[model samples]
Target: MDQYVEILHWNTQHGRKLDAAIAWLRKRAKAAGRMPAALMLNELQPGQGEHVGGELGLLHYPAPVDDGLDPADSRRRNLNAIFIDPDGPLVPDPEWVANWTGPWMPPATLPVNLRNPDGTLSSRQLYLACEHACYWHPGYRETTARFYTVLGKDGRLVHVDGDFNAWTVGRAPLTLANVADRAFAQNRSVLCGTALVADDIADRLMTAGGFVYVHGHAAEYLGIEGADAPTTDHGPDKERQLIPEEDQPERGLSAIDRTYTTAELIPAVIDANVITDPDVDALADHKPRYTRYGYPDLVAITNLPVELVHH
Candidate 1:
């Protein structure tokens, strides 16, 4: 039995090189009364343009020895032999397997509208809801905001919320009070009996005007506590002084400073009624203390009754 076979530099323009090669090998195997364990077809000239040819290969192994098995069943038994045969020297490398298998078929396109019959929310709307929740706060070294998506009965994305925390400079022990105080200092004003941080988020959502609030404890929602104090970089005062002042919101400001700026714009977030407690239990049931990637963290307290059409 030949352990290996090679078909080198065959021109593809001569037509169906693989079929021709296989046919030639089958005739050789029939003449020899045994099949080659592996076949290596190298430098095949798939002639079309100015480009050169590529390589192609194939491998097959004989089935396990069994006196009871009929000789006619040998090919069928050996169909996957190359991959499983321990004694076979020719192993199917990933590239060789992939080439043999050909390219994967593309997945079918999903329906354009992935909304429930009630038409309350579309798939796109649900995705945006998650994004809005995550994007509300900008990333900072001292603060971390992590959001999670909530699915409805239909397994579509429906709601999202986050676990947010920020470290602050303070003498008090790391209590919720300290965190709330820091949050308050950051956004300077309270609205509708909620903390300044909560008010800021509420305001942004209200102005956009689509999502309905079921229940939100703005204090707890925007609360931060028990975080380590931010370390000060003790660079030279002269070098620090040389840094010019810039109006960019993310630059040269503490979390508190940014929150205070949001407070100044509190009037923009009108309609405090937009923040309501319709299904408190649902909110509590869905809200999560922590979430891993791809899981819902919060309750479906918020609903978007209409789809947004972007211009």
Candidate 2:
């Protein structure tokens, strides 16, 4: 998606290639009688160019994203949310913005938005941020941020971006040392800590329903499979009822594995929201370690109905 969007942004054709690709995608989905776009888009160059999202009938962040800075400026990196589809909420986050060297610039950071035009908190969720700019960089290592979720007036928290404390969060040690945790520890740098920070943020910005519908992958890691099959109860199971057995897997997980700077984020997001532990209940209790998060059950993605289960 980033590649396609990038082409749309920089290519002389602009908007043309992305439109073509979206057309192809919609065509395929229509032919199969499946949802056309379960999309999560990011790195979307902020602007109203073509508004492909609107054309495809996807819900968007609907806030002004321009930070009023040069596109080359790092502070304005995520000022705009390119796209936000419940199914495709995940976006690719290139640690190396444009300077993609293994480590070209240390402190590779940017800021995020905290409010909307109506003054309602603009942050729909936390996966949209990283620790304050003080933490990113070309030097990938394993230390967490002093302010894990965000950095504001009092330096209360540290996250990808935000200017104020939209809400309050407690301070606690997150030495879980999970997979991404270990990688950052070994390398002395890891974005996985962002998970903990985002976990905390999602607690405030989201509800159980937000988690229920957010089944899309970080990038194109669509959570489609018999295990992850969309569990819509009433309407119709497009992937199953309309599509054939052979084509079902395609609707499930794509052969393209390395979801890149993305795939890791999906599970990270799950870890933030759901209780992966195969014991206890999600809707009944929160993951003991996390507060104000999780659900009654952590069943396969396909097991739940396609309705929003608001918290």
Candidate 3:
């Protein structure tokens, strides 16, 4: 029942550290009655400071001969994979998670929704009002900035980074129009954070016969526990009694006090593609997997395929 095993190498000795780690993992895998399907070695790169590691090489253990080795034995081949530690400097941050307040700078304008004088879309609106309602954690700001840029460029649609905020924004008459435009461009599949948003977006888009890629919360959809979830700071008004309950569950709900940013969303986009690589699609679509799983603490990662159940 040992489905997957990952080994992280951090020896500054470079090649030697990698070799040593692989050897150790091989022995461990053998004892566990498991054969490595692939061995990926990630070593530190040059001048990446001491934190960075190199390429993550994958070593898959063939069946039978590679299985059932003693954990204490050094020659054991019971390994799912033998690779360097994932947490290295060269690894890029995931776009889905948002940015950490590192040395990176913030965006010039807060990408948000525009509003009219009546708190709705104006017949003659001048500038788009970016929704400054979502949560911007210290580290996740970088992600928010990037998301804003993408949304701004693709003005035809409203890229709702599915969290509570998207609903709040969608409820806005003006913002809803943009959402409708994008949804119509695609099917009724605006990438949503959760099925909740996905369904909601689909309904609204359907009103105008429109849709977009519904980006759901990978953590929830994929059953990834302990992972961080995106959030925002906006919510529906308590006194707005005209809206139907089924029409808008998020109306009464509040915005996420904290949320993920664009810096994080990028890597997520990659990882989702990699982990969900189906029918050997991963062979060509595994780069994001390498970058995302390169973190040291991440032992086993799963990229759930965007299946029908998820939708």
Candidate 4:
């Protein structure tokens, strides 16, 4: 079947990485003899005022068709849309973009109440709202954001000097209503702390439905006694650790698990991986996670029957 993919909100730095990904996909499609009809790359232009708009000029690439097949055949033209952002700075606010002139309009809007204490929308809030909107939007088959350690100039993982804000919402089946409720509730349920545990311990906690945010001095903060706590042995020294482990007692063990609201967990994961990664200041110069969008709610959407696309 023909697929439609749209990539939204990518900057110059992301362009090179995206190009490599697309090339790999195209090569694979050719091997399978199921190449797509067309691919589109939509860049984010500076929006008017505080909002941002997609660049009008789309970098479109048409697939090379077979010799005998007609290019206009409907069966030959499936659509696949992919949205790529190394760091998700732009929130897809449809209401704000309705009047704007562009081929791509944001698929959703931010809820009225998800604002900061000063009655303004924070970047994190805006991204969360967009994620909430995508969850329920019929047009999107699925969505996700992935978090990874940021690299430093010395060709190593960057270290976070300050406290790691392990922000967390609740578990999955997250909907717009509950997300808004959590965001606006006077005494909303969320988990925010700076605790780091042993990698094995973190893995165990995640297995139980919880998440752990680790960073510089995480070993000392969590009192990890093992040697694995301070090295880059299991991949990059993870800036943060997020597990699915639920809030519960340590039982016979010394570690403890805490459950979080969906609102708290989603942004917490994003903050650790994307919004506040160690290289936030030098994002353009560092290598970001290959797949930059993920959260439990979004992960749920991914398991559904949607066309998979990424950068």
Candidate 5:
């Protein structure tokens, strides 16, 4: 089945102002008999009560409002109240395929294409290209202003930081395919896992899920170490060290190739695992696990594509 997300309003006001807007939309939505399915706010994490939105600073969608945790919680609001038949009117007619012929379609073919009643060829490639230019465009600042209410949660856009303590060797491999697959296979239930446990992977997954990635620290693209970079080793005297690209084991490629910032990475999600340069092998060989040790909700089994998930 195909899904649609409606941003009810996109107000730019941050903090309490955004909260008030959300409250207003919920009341109207309820009155209109359109219950929300999932919310895609600009804040980063889920939380309880109004304060949670205030706390996150609105860089990304705040965490889902837990009904059990706060039945009265209004923050976890959704706007995609209208559901359409995945095969008809909503999708273009040219994209529709008969059931017998649909199976032969490529994985990249969209569900909408298989059943669109509009008859226009809804090219998946075109969809992605448009989406990239619109949502993931270079230096695009996402906001809930046009689609959702502008309650008080507004702040800076959040990004997931890939730079962990270099000595944090015990960390698991990162991928979005693993988490999305599990979420889909497991019936979209929230899998229990800590923020620190598969931290890098989860951040990426959340971004795929349409939330802002809030990497608290700065990230260098391509894993290149800049001058006066801090040593990632453990123990005392682990001071900042200037290292060459070839000599820096932590960095896998040339500094010129370095462009791995969240700003760059989110849009280039498809390229995350592809071995463009011959030198980088770690990402090429790694197959992400569902639950490494105790961590659950690992996203990728192998380097899988996570760009533009259709949940």
Candidate 6:
């Protein structure tokens, strides 16, 4: 039967956000109508094991070594979630205890394709993915996003960055959603259609959520465009004018174009049917946030790049 999966994503590194995370999850459950039948907690440890043993109850023959201790404790550092069930023990997947984290798709759960009404949060599973191995890496960021995206099934996934230490995810999901999710899918009773935790390079952390909004940090594609656009990580894709092959350009000196700034971006969103580069408007805030966090970033956007596309 198609059920609902309420997600609560939070970084367990500093682990101080435990209380807040729990509250958010409880709210998610309340909105979903019923608590999850099973919870899938990612990045438990040891090759990101899919472990089922968490703060909540269980079914069938339980597994050993329940690291449900308060990960908030410095010595324990075991970030776990609360699993609740009264019927019987929620049998752990064979691989559940094979490692630290439990199987992403609980034993009886199916993969989320999000192709129909049955695809979305219908899994009735609570998935809590937290922290990288031990350090912070872009690989972790991308994979975590991808995994959550899968859980979201076609863009139904809701990415909540418990912590944005290295500026993990922000306005990035907006584009991903456009590509993976439905136009304006609202499944859960609570929360928006989607939410991507965001932040800027200069500032701390800010929450980013919404259908067209994806946030981790604009740093990946923020200011510093122009002739130098191609020098950044996303340079190859940044909006830029390519020098024709006929123009036999200089050796080391290559071709170039400019990115779009919010000033020239949002107005375009108001009228245009398609945006070649939506990244610019994804983080578009009416009140530019020079500080890097908060709703001010919705429009103000202290720093807007040039030549972004949305379509």
What TM-score fits each model? 0.19, 0.28, 0.20, 0.21, 0.19, 0.27
lDDT of 1 at 117: 30
Q: Which ten residues in a row have the lowest lDDT in candidate 1?
A: 102-111
lDDT of 6 by residue, 176-293 (tens): 2222223211110112246522212211111212212122123223331231212112223422322223332232221111111112122222110111233322221110011111
Better of 2 and 6 by TM-score: 2
- Candidate 5 C-alpha lDDT tens digits along 77-193: 221011122322223234433121111101111122222223333232111000000111111112211111111012211222111111111222222233423432222122336
Better of 1 and 6 by lDDT: 6
* Deviation from native of the Cα of residue 105 in model 6, angstroms: 20
Report how far off residue 137 is in candidate 3 (Å): 21
| Cα lDDT of model 1 by residue, 199-268, tens digit | 2343233223332221122112323231111112223432421212332123222221011111111222
Better of 2 and 4 by TM-score: 2
State the number of backbone clashes in model 5: 51
Clashes of 4: 43
Q: What is the Cα-based lDDT of residue 112 in candidate 5?
A: 23
Give the per-residue lDDT of model 4 (tens digit) for 54-140: 321222221122334464542123211223221222223334321111111221212111222333433322221111111112222
Candidate 3 residue-wise lDDT, 1-311, digit = tens: 12222212111222334344435445644684542322232222222222112322321111112224353432121111122222211111122222222222211121111222233321211111111212213223334434444433311222222222233234322222234244332222233463212223322332232222222233345444322222221134322222334544343422221122222222233222112323222122111121122222111111212222211
* Local distance difference test scores for all models: 0.23, 0.26, 0.25, 0.23, 0.23, 0.26
Q: How many clashing residue pairs, candidate 3?
A: 87
The candidate scoring highest on TM-score is 2
Task: Name model 6 segments beyond 4 Å from true.
Answer: 1-3, 12-33, 37-92, 95-97, 100-311
